[model samples]
Target: MTETVEIARGPYRAQLLALGATLRRLEVPDREGRVANVVLGCRDLDDYRRVARYYGATVGRYANRIGGARFMLDGREYRLPANDGPNNLHSGAPGFDQRDWALEDADASSARFGLTSPDGENGFPGTLRVEALYRMEEDGLAITLSAQTDAPTVLNLTNHAYFNLGGEASGRTILDHVLRIAGSHITPVDADLIPTGALRPVANSPFDFRTPKPVGRDIAQDDTQLVRGLGYDHNWAIDAPGRAATLYDPESGRVLDLHSTKPGLQLYSGNHLADGPPGTSGGTYAARAGLCLEPQLFPDSPNRPEFPSARLDPGERYEHRLAFRFRTAGSVDEAFG
Candidate 1:
């Protein structure tokens, strides 16, 4: 395995690897001027390859779930690998997360990684070309993803980074992290965690994050959605793509402002993160050890006509922009200000 590439600017520093175009480390400072590694992962690249967990990697051909591991495209049915029950999760096993990307360019402030997927690979049509750009600005990290395919194919790409703002790998969880999402609706999943093809309102449910609230505030409610997700694994329908969500850690005084152009944000509470390898921060992680806020198109969008389309044509190019604005402040307003 090759060495990881690191980029630094101001108080923000990040480590990137060509393997899956993954982010090996992301360090940010708090109000006391003390820095902590917020992103969770092992120190070795082999651990990532063997573990197969998305971690801080760039996940694609399709980022989330696809119902029945199948989709009908242009009157043809395509069957994908059933890696997640009867559904396809993160493009199935040995998907993008397990592949090594080629380094197109690298510098102190940014680096670009690229991958080319052949037709019929992973049971998806088209030869897909994808690029991921990781840039370190003065206050945040920006990732711009672009893709093109030789044939019409479904694609939804996103970074699967698990975050722990409270600054510990063991007993410290994300329960106290105050989070606010600009979503008024969500694409609820079923027993298999596949979207039910409905964009239901979040007005009176534990899924509401329009206003700031603790992550564990309603996670244990008797709601069926909560029970189905195990925590907050469902995708929240985001309207203002400019302002997708905002998360703050009272203990560390660290704030992360999420900005994306995607239609949905998957807020996973790391319910199934148990029995994982020891983290770089030094602990055997358990459930709720971290939280993931993945911004992308809705899961199972290929089969859901009502949701935004994820199809890319021969002459068309797909582009997505995501930014995690980080700062040390008392509240969300100060972080943005």
Candidate 2:
């Protein structure tokens, strides 16, 4: 119900809401010259709050799970609200996804949202100034997340956008979407979906996405990890630094190339997307309706020393870049590089 920003260029158009600095709509053209909304989202800001919490919002403080909802930073233990069973999820309830960011700047092709998180907010020890910048590029969107803290604390930020490149309301599930992850190893998780602090080879296993494969091809196989996540909700360590993964929809001839500076990516196959309100694209969402490619620090990075550190101290500026480039079948290769 507030003022929303719009970005348009070429055949792409996106609507961004200041509430949560969330992406409300993303439309691109298919091969047939017909445009379709590709991202899942609610009809209004109220629906976004009552139903799916993340949707197309920027999630943070710490983006993923932290074991036991607590972690030790510099010999000091920090306890966060247990939003996900016994673990901290998306920085707990009332997270950044629930806040309305200040509209710092906007234009025809980009928008900038800013927020300041005080020390002790979300149980993190820092007064952090943050920014989520969106820039519409030649064939895709680039998001830059940056932050600076006044105290030592752990932080990981990411955009949680559920995408169905076949067109969000095509009444077609994303099970047939082909995906290629840039990693051969994935962080295994426990029954509660918390990382077990071990990176296991996906070779010859159902977790293998080293090569291009359909999401539903091996999704129902009898596997412990799949059972725990209800589908695929694990993080893949990036084998290639600049590029993390790619998703292609053969039916619609749409492709998404993911390039990021983060070390890992959480590939979630919208297992719990049901019971949501009507989507902006006139579709009622259900489980596995869309998929998320969240590029960020490893889950529970603060607790697992083996993972890349997510600590930012006084005067230290944190910055990361992520881009999701959209292209058609024939131009996917050239657009990606």
Cα displacement (angstroms), candidate 2, residue 277, comes to 1.5
Q: For residues 11-104, what per-residue lDDT tens digits would candidate 2 score against the true structure?
A: 8899998878898788988778789989998875688666545988999899989999999998999999998999999998678888879999
**TM-score of model 1 (CA atoms):** 0.97
* Number of clashes recorded per candidate: 0, 0
**How many clashes show up in model 1?**
0
Instruction: Assess every candidate by TM-score.
Output: 0.97, 0.97
As a whole number from 0 to 100, the lDDT of residue 81 in candidate 2 is: 93
